[model samples]
Target: MRVVHVASEVFPFSRSGGLGDVLGALPAQQARLGAQVTVVSPWYADITQAVREVWRGPLEVPGSVPLTDVRVGAFTEGGVQFLFVGLDAFDRPGLYFPDDVWRFTQFGRAVLPALEQVGVVPDVLHGHDWQAGLVVARARLAGLRAVFSVHNLQYQGRWNLMDGVGWTGLPDGVFTAEGLEFHGDVNLMKAGLVFASQVTTVSPTYAQEITTPEYGEGLDGLLIRLTHEGRLSGILNGLDQERWDPRTDADITPFGQLAGKAACGAALRAEFGLDDAPILATVSRLAEQKGMDLLIAALPELTRAWNVVVLGGGDPRLEAGLREWDAHPRVAFAQGMNEPLAHRIYAGADAFAMPSRFEPCGLSQMIAMRYGTLPVVRETGGLVDTVPHEVGFRFAGATPEALADACAAARLTFDDHAEWAARAQEAMSLDFSWDGPTREYLGLYARVLSGPLRPLVGLERA
Candidate 1:
């Protein structure tokens, strides 16, 4: 099977979050499984890290208004192919620029023509998030098979109706309440949700959660409708084990190098000047959605028994909370993403804290488990699917009390040496490999090819 993936971000080229990681690993993994995959993403101005494989075509995005020139290029490395949409439109600093909708609109429209230039029409075009949502809509309108993946529902690309309709030349009918319209604005994510042959989120539990009003981010009604029509589904995301394995990591002192987690933890504690208490670490964006507020609220009670370390940065209010908690001698907070430090922390920490309010197939908990660090997480989204009692500790709610209870359980378990060792070993053995999820995605693709939803309703001009 041939798959063309469209997204705003792909790691090593451009990235802001987990979406990039997924696209980076999954396409390569899928290729390894014998499916031909090519990903189309914007070529940002600051992307100087990757050398171009070949310059394919200096092509024009067909039927484009305010006619702009864009060069289509190819990049083949590590067994996966990449078709980069290169033009001044995307030649901007940072992951997000001033006119994002305009940039992605041009990007979405460029896929088919670029593919044509390369002489390959894929069996499926997979769109990720609102950034590439329009691609799925455009593909389906042109009667091509397409699949859409919703990484996060919170940031739907919304713009004025006139601007969106004019820039993309999308049919007027597609801007209605039943289409891409959200309130008074044109929502880009709606294109994928309403027009694709099938819509999928990162995890099955999140797929179920998004269909409800509680976790839907205001698109629950439509998602529920899609679910009822059998057009909505979920496939859990997987890990790139090559980079996450503790045994071979050069940055972190491996278990083989040190006697094990005990010696490693002692060294890390001494290195960070932290107390020798059982280490509980969190590595995530400090946002309310990640339940950072709950972690903060439970800090006083938690730090009394366990030493804490945190990595990642987001939201000023969250930073202030972390600063306030830093007053506690046992708690150490490190801001921003440090690949080496993260690996070391995961390897050294006794328990990993991921008290997320709503996680869409979180990879950190899985990574922590792989490094022999049992996770203490809320029973939400991928956390529940991946972390069971046999492997890690879990709580039922997003509240502070619930998180406190779970942490207490973790602390109690940590006090029991034999039990803790067994659980850590069990967690390390849990498989979150790409093989299973990749196979599931392939199956979904085959199913869609066998019976694709044609003439996707509510896309034509009224």
Candidate 2:
């Protein structure tokens, strides 16, 4: 079957966060499963690979419906196809800049012509996030079957009714409260929910959470409606083991110790310039959503015994504060994206911390688990699903105290060689592969295409 993944970002080319990680890994896995998977993304500046421009043709969208010529590029890596839609507007550093509505709408509308030109009409159009949701919706309207995955529903592409309706060429009725419109704006994410043959969230727990107002971000009612209509489902995301494995990782100095935690800790400390002080690391986009504020607030109390190394940059306030603290005797903050450094941190840190207030399905915690570093996480989203009670410590509440206490618990394991070793071995042995999710998706696609659930899938919830 042919499956086309539409998104604004793809890993190793244009990456902002876990969304890129998912796109980079999942398509390859789907290809391995015997499906022809292609990714459609915007051309960003950081993408250095040689991309061939395949077409420059006019596209017809809703409003202006002008057959304005759009540039198209084709690039393939790891057996997965990529279509980089080039707009003089989107060719800038940012994927969505001045007129984001026009940029994405044009990208969405232009995909059909591009696909037709390539002589490949996909069996399933799998769209991701809001940036690409309109493309899937437009594809569906163009008589293609589409599956929409909500990595996070909070970032709905919403615009004022006049501007959105004009750009999308959508009916004025779609600008209402219940349709593609929300609060007098046309919401691209909502349009995906309304038009997609099926809607999927990253995790089962998140699927349940988004139905409530707290995590829903004003789209809970819409999700609940979709749930009632039997169009919504949840599938947990998976880590790319090829990039995350400790044994073959090119970044970390010391290799894997399949059975001992003490030896691993010692090796890690030597590599990171920490002398036996329990090294705790965090790799995350420093944002309020990631609970970085709480992490910083808890640091004063945490610096008594442990050494902290932070990687990642976002939120100027958090970045600037971490930069100041980087000079501290025990704390180290790298302050930007360093993949090798991240792998080193995962290998070297005695414990990894992720205190997200709400995590849809974090790849870092799983990557940390692969490195045999115990994770100290807030119990939410995929963290709740992946981080077992025996593997590490969990904080029940989204408070500094809860996070601090979890860190303290992880530190205790770090201090006790035997306990930490056993936990590390257990985490390393666990499997968090894409095989399961890919199979689930295949079954879901078969059901949608055939007009009902297949007997082999047995949709009763695994």
Candidate 3:
């Protein structure tokens, strides 16, 4: 099968978050599984210099921008073709610019032509998140099958109706209640949710959560209808085991050797000037959605038993809040993204804390578990699916007290060396690899291919 993945980011070339990571690993895995895969993403200013030009032409953009210069650059890695689309609007410093609505609108418009220029007639166009949402509608109009995956529901690409409607060049009728319209705005996400052959989220629990009023982000009614129509699904995201493996990682002591994790832990404690206490580490963005505020509130109680190390930066207020703990004897806060430190923290920490208020599917917990570090997470989204009682600790409520309780439980297990070792071993042994999820995607694609194209209901071609 031929498959094309359209997204704003792809790892090793351009990445901002989990969507990039997923696009990086999933397509490669699919390629390994015998599907001819191609990933299309914007060629941002900071993209690696390694991507060479392969195709270039004038792209016929509809609506406002009638035509623009389009360049397609590519390289093959892990049997999958990586295609980068270049346009002046995307020649910015960041993967996501301030004018993202217009930038990705152009990106969405460029996808099909980019594919055509590269000679790829895909069986399925899998678009990720709101940034790539409009591609689904465009693909469908061309009679191609498309699957839209919602990585996070909260970030629907919304803009003023007049501006966004013109950029899409879709029929005026499509900007209505049954189409891309949402609360008097043009919601790009709604286009995918309403018109795609299938709609999927990152995890099973999240898929169910998004169809409810609590987590739906005001699209519950539409999601409910899609679920009933048998077009919505949840396939749990998987880890790229090779890149995250503890066995071959040169950053820390390899898993089975002498001193092993203990040596790494000792070194980490010394690096941070932390005292000899059980270490609890968190490698995450400091945001409320990640439950950072709750973690901060629980610090006074938590620091009594476990030394804490935080790596990552976001939300200046949250950053300031966490910095106050830097003076505490048992807490170490390292702001910003440090890849090497993250690997070390995963290997050395006794337990990893991911107290997310609502995580769709987190890669950090899985990475921590892979390094024989236990995960203490709130029971929501994929956290509920991956971290079972036997492998890690979990809490129900999204509160400081609940996170503390979970950590307290993990601390208890940490004190019992034998039991802790057993649990850590079990976690490392569990398979979070992409092999299973890749096969599941292939199956979904086959199903989509056999089914007829979903009608646009009230939508019309321009």
Residue pairs clashing, model 1? none
The runs of at least 3 residues in candidate 2 whose Cα sits more than 4 Å from the true structure, single-residue gaps closed, are 65-67, 96-99, 258-273, 452-462
* Candidate 1 lDDT tens digits, 1-462: 999899988987877778988988999999999999998888777777664645454555443464356666677877888888776777667778667887788777777777787777889989999988888878887888888999988878889877787777667777789888888887889888888888999999999999888889899999999899888998999998987887878876666322366767877798778886889999998899999999989998998889999988988898888987776789888888887888889888988999998998999998988888889999988888889878798998889999989999989888898888888888887888999999999998998999945664655563
Clashes of 3: 0
Alpha-carbon local distance difference test for all models: 0.84, 0.81, 0.89
Pairwise lDDT winner, candidates 1 and 3: 3
| Worst 10 contiguous positions by lDDT, candidate 1 | 59-68
lDDT by residue (85-119, candidate 2, tens digit) is 87665756654465776678767666777778877
RMSD to the hidden true structure, all candidates: 2.1, 4.5, 1.3
Ranking by TM-score: 3, 1, 2
Better of 1 and 2 by TM-score: 1
Span of 10 residues, lowest total lDDT, candidate 2: 453-462
Candidate 3 lDDT, tens digit per residue, 362-414? 99999998888899999899999899799899998999999999899989888
